[model samples]
Target: MDTTQRALAVGVGAALLQALMLIAFAWPAANIAPRDLPIAVTGPQADLVVGQLAERSPGAFDVSRPADEAAARAAIEDRDVYGAIVTGDGPPRVLIASAASPAVAQQLTQIGQQLSGGPAARVDDVVAADSDDPRGTAFGAMVLPLALSGIAAGVLLGLLIPTIGGKALGLATFGVVGGLLSMEVIQGWMSLVPGPYLVLAAVAGLVSFAVSGAVVGLSAAIGRAGIGIAALTMLLVGNPFSAATSAPELLPKPWGAIGQLLPPGAAASLLRSVAFFDGAGASGPLAVLVIWAVAALTLLGVGALRTRPANEPATAAPIPVTTG
Candidate 1:
């Protein structure tokens, strides 16, 4: 009823929403399942491996064939395939890209051992995660900071600038700088994500720009409520859906599909492409980020137009007509 009461209610609601967000993400994550995982196979026993997988797990794999070991390695490195099974005269060798998806890598190795003569098979990780980060924990950790940085840039800039042009300029600048700085800290200082410095930095910048633009646009359109909504969407919903820890197919039906459609998921996918996959699977994610950035910019433009004062001439002050 009162101002203080309304403010207190709003605060309480935000806190409650945050709790729900944690549950929304944690619940699905606690229950993990691998579905339609992509993999590559080649050589003599390739057909046998595929057949056995079909028999054993039904819909476990989306298998492809590479020409040779070299091609298989390439597929794994570029993330075109998460793991590759190369079958030959001796025990089958499983090549995995642990850096891309550590969980999938472990699964493939176990599968290889079973498929091979119990203890004879070898599991080789071509693009292994760094020793310090054996399971690519750093990959998952990177997304949180990136999302926060974007939100910070958006909220701060949106408050400081009244015009759309000013806000847009501020957000863009922050995206580029924040992106480069974050990469330098993560990769240069910490060696978390190792790749071509320039390319990685560029991808980071693009992601920052998209996230920042989205937040700023949303806030401009709906004031403080916009910021809260953006946080709920990106930080809570988007982060869990992002296939950072595992492949999209590994997640449940609607969730995997939903994550790809949002900014956080799209950005994480783009980062993986640049860092390890040589940008092989970047097109879809890159397109997604582009669309998000464009839409946010449009929202900002609309907000700016609405802020302009009305063109109708002001009415003159009421005449003091006194009947004496």
Candidate 2:
């Protein structure tokens, strides 16, 4: 095709990409609602409250009957449930882990009010988010930038450093520096997270490594196209479905599960675990990040094996000699 035809094609392609991006981002936000959100309930009204919840929202909550208020509190602290309801004796009380998810906490508080047959119900935030970020807005907004940082690091390394070994080293360095910087800003400057300084930094670093490694690995394996693949996966699929702003249950089914598999989602969960839940629910997300990092390294190794270095001296063809 001529230049004008190519320009037109490019314009149309850009428009289509814009449309897809809009749908990817907006669809999840528009359709967000609880889907089997875990919660605990106790006391004499446990069965009745569970019944009401099921009747009202059908399949919205996955209710667990904890033995008592203490058990429910433990569940919330351990990251097993987002919230709990204690019904019996006095007015119903709601236990929430705002650090887990402020959106879920508000939802639980509302539910408690409804169950109480009063305008307000007693509410307690068993594990509250940091005071500076009470609503978790900062925390939620953090994942995208971190993901982008990793992507940028990988892209730069891929372009600037031609050697696979050099790229690997760059990715590791970026991960470490990026993690420390992110932690300093979010924890020290903003006080958004209340976790241990070094631990949070380490977690942040791991996330960075996982994301950058994936991008670098894919680029090494598939040339420039790998960059686009990694960016789109992290941005369109991983960021929106990450559930960073809300609980995984709040996101649409399958997508939420899918997000957890991606670096962004896994990062969010792992960060939250270390920051608020004392690493109670850390294993799964930690494993996910490890797997991603490993896969990226493996891809890098494959690329190294398959790709010929541009700087390598060409092998000399065997000189054929004819004797006269």
Candidate 3:
């Protein structure tokens, strides 16, 4: 057994250990269901109703007693509550914002009705969603744009670092534009991704532009290694850690906490808010995106300054006097 072989074995073992750890962290995090989504209760027996609901489905609904029907509706509208129950003389009525994921709203409605002894329940859907958007589609709406942006960023990083020619830049621009246009056309014309075409396009463009700028800047600063770091941050950590596919409350605490800080996660959340959630509680995600964009731009500027030739003579050299 040679020393080199032993060292190679150790390296492989270490790599395997790291991979396992990452997988362990991400796997369970992905599967855990989001529990205890806020739900407002308003009725003569709101407390009793909430208690019954909790008994039926433990840890599923986090019920809050609102002052009145208006407050309950407002909570749903503000995204403070996923849905609400308002009891009346005949049967309990469920109020769900149209902006919430249809699946969740439906589930809540069914649960509310069931808890109230299967009586007919009136449903009030505020903040109506797009007709074409289907139930459980919110996650897809959020992630698609972020994924496209990441791809664009990777390509841009490749092109910008090597000091590509003006033609290349033109080509790159065309590609980005074409890709985004294609996405819009497919989503709108073909109905590939439900909802407003213009809105989707706008979100996608913003995400792509921000990601590309960040990648270019990072690459400029640290060369090839910068791209690797960017990938680790944006793609590896950001996408999986993002609570798009599953809500943050479902994810393990670590991933949920870290996910909010990343670009894809932030963008996805904002998109979901705008699309399915009716722009409910969107300020936080928007702030995250803004911060990321500003930080990346600043980094890009620093990288540019660092790359400038420090000792280059500014003035044209005076031709040496010819000694005749």
Candidate whose TM-score is highest? 2
Instruction: Mark the regions of model 2 whose C-alpha exceeds 4 Å error after superposition.
Output: 309-312, 318-324
Give the backbone clash total of model 2.
0
Q: Summarize candidate 2's per-residue lDDT along 109-143 as a digit string, tens digits.
A: 99999888899999999999989899999999999
lDDT of 3 by residue, 118-200 (tens): 76667888655555554546444556455555556555655554542332353346436744785566565655355565665
Give the alpha carbon lDDT tens digit for every residue of 288-316 in model 1.
Answer: 98898898899897777667654347889
Per-residue error for 177 in candidate 1, Å, reads: 1.4
lDDT score for candidate 2 against the true structure: 0.91
Q: Which candidate is the best by lDDT?
A: 2
lDDT for 144 (candidate 2): 93
Residue 28, model 2: Cα distance from true site in angstroms: 0.8
- How many Å off is the CA of 201 in candidate 3? 2.9
**Better structure of 1 and 3 per TM-score:** 1
